[model samples]
Target: MTESAFRCLACGDGHSVAVHKAVADYFLPTGIRVDYVRCAACGMVQQYPVPTDVGPFYAAYPVHARKSLLQEVTRRILLSPVYYDVASLRRDQLLLDYGCGDGWFLDRAKRRVSAAYGYEPTAMQASRVAERVGVQVFHDVAALRAPLAGRVDVITMHFVLEHLTDLSGTFALLADLLKPGGTLHAVIPNLDNVEYRGFGSRWHGFDAPRHICFPNADQLKPVLDPLGLRLASDRFVPFPNTLAASLSILFTGRYRLLPFLAFLPLAIVWARLYPRGTRALTFVKHEN
Candidate 1:
């Protein structure tokens, strides 16, 4: 068998070799096989032979659904600090939720800032979100930047960066959009998480095809630090979604809810004991 080769998207390092095999896409169960690679140089994990046509998979994405009251409350408790951090950065400045799927975060942020905007790649969802939120939901960077009229004070890419294909170019665009002294908040899958260790290729974070890159703090910091984006805080966050996805892979080999319910308590305890699977990182753009 010939060993496949890949470069680390986060660090641009060669010598990234396959460490896991035949990982299936947890979301779109197409029976397509892919290898997961870990860069020896920077320790970033990514799927090899990146899926070229992901449009069909995303057309049925479930993020557009409204959250239940309990789910919303739980998110507020666990993630309010993340929003507060954005609000604290500067008052009366625009806040942009990059990859704002359905405008969930932007709807909440509109209350904190004078204006809130969002950028989502899905045109249909972006249009729906713009109508629902009564704020701009742009489908492209140019459309997003034009309305901002100036650099944004804060931007967030919650669980969005991993889905991106171009790490350096994306970060550069983000840096350019940020005002001097502005902040960028991102939450990405932690490759060091217990779930990945326990579940291996089936780990929910893999999300194969869809999640192009997985970078732990060590792997990610070096990529952004040189861009003048200084780390302000780094902390692990608990995501029930990952737990649910893991359980689905374990039992039925698909995303379902019964496993999530059965494993909710264990997931909470796991997060309390080992909160290294997913991380919330805040970075500040250096002032000129």
Candidate 2:
């Protein structure tokens, strides 16, 4: 109804480019209609008119959880480097998982890191995370005071940072939670991927309201660097099932097994063709 406005979450650069105005209903999982835009200055993609109620946006999370064999294999494929990138595996190493929904990754990270904890904004999912993974989940950072302060060795945010409405506050909180050389690991959708170029507004990754910010390598660098964090390494790790799902979405607008007919070769071809474009990334927080 009204023209939306936005200031760049990274550089404070404002924009008014109407790249595409579409509703992402089914895929968002957040169940909120969203308006998408692209920045003219830095080419970053983001959602406009931030949602007022963050509740329904994350309400369907725990209720509609999925951890199939395909998801497990994909996690292994993309998470290997994340483990190797940390390079400090030992017992009693306290780790915090920001926005850990259902604690699937936390379940695995616990095996490597001595101590694992997580915080989930969604109340329903946060409860399940603790019940399922045996880790405590706070409603927000402010809830975590003396106990978690300055004790976490590694802080992780998998597919989490993009949803933040406050980067400065979020990062500052994460920074405070970490020990002196502690690292903050995050994985998010790659805005520079060729799949987005080929699919345009139909790109499956842009799940609208849920994915508020679709940042690329360049967009993320300046944002994190100011927080004493750096992009230690970034790589493309393709998930065959997700790629197949994308192909299904592009063709028929719903996931189907028929397109998975050439699942093997298609996966390899897509991975090779657009390696860096895959929604794969591993970043570490650096200490000054």
Off by more than 4 A, model 1: 1-5, 67-90, 147-150
Which regions of candidate 2 fall more than 4 Å away from where they truly are? 1-4, 26-32, 62-88, 256-265, 272-274, 279-288
Best by TM-score: 1
The TM-score of candidate 2 is 0.83
- For model 1, the local distance difference test gives 0.75
Give per-residue CA lDDT, model 2, range 1-288, as digits (tens). Answer: 454357766656776588777666545444456787777778777777656566667655432386779867855764554333444656768888888766777787777777778888767677877888887878767877568877888787877877887666787788778777777766776667667777665555665666778777677666777777666656765544446556776777744557644454686576666555444444555666
lDDT of 1 by residue, 1-288 (tens): 233446678777767666887776777655666777778788778866555676755655777766789877876765564343544644578788888876767877787787788888878888999998888888886665555644788888988988887788788778878887888889888877667888887778777767888876567776677777888888876665676668777888777767766776777676666677788888898853
Clashing pairs in 2: 193-277
TM-score of every candidate: 0.88, 0.83
* Root-mean-square deviation of every model: 2.8, 3.3
Give lDDT for model 2.
0.67
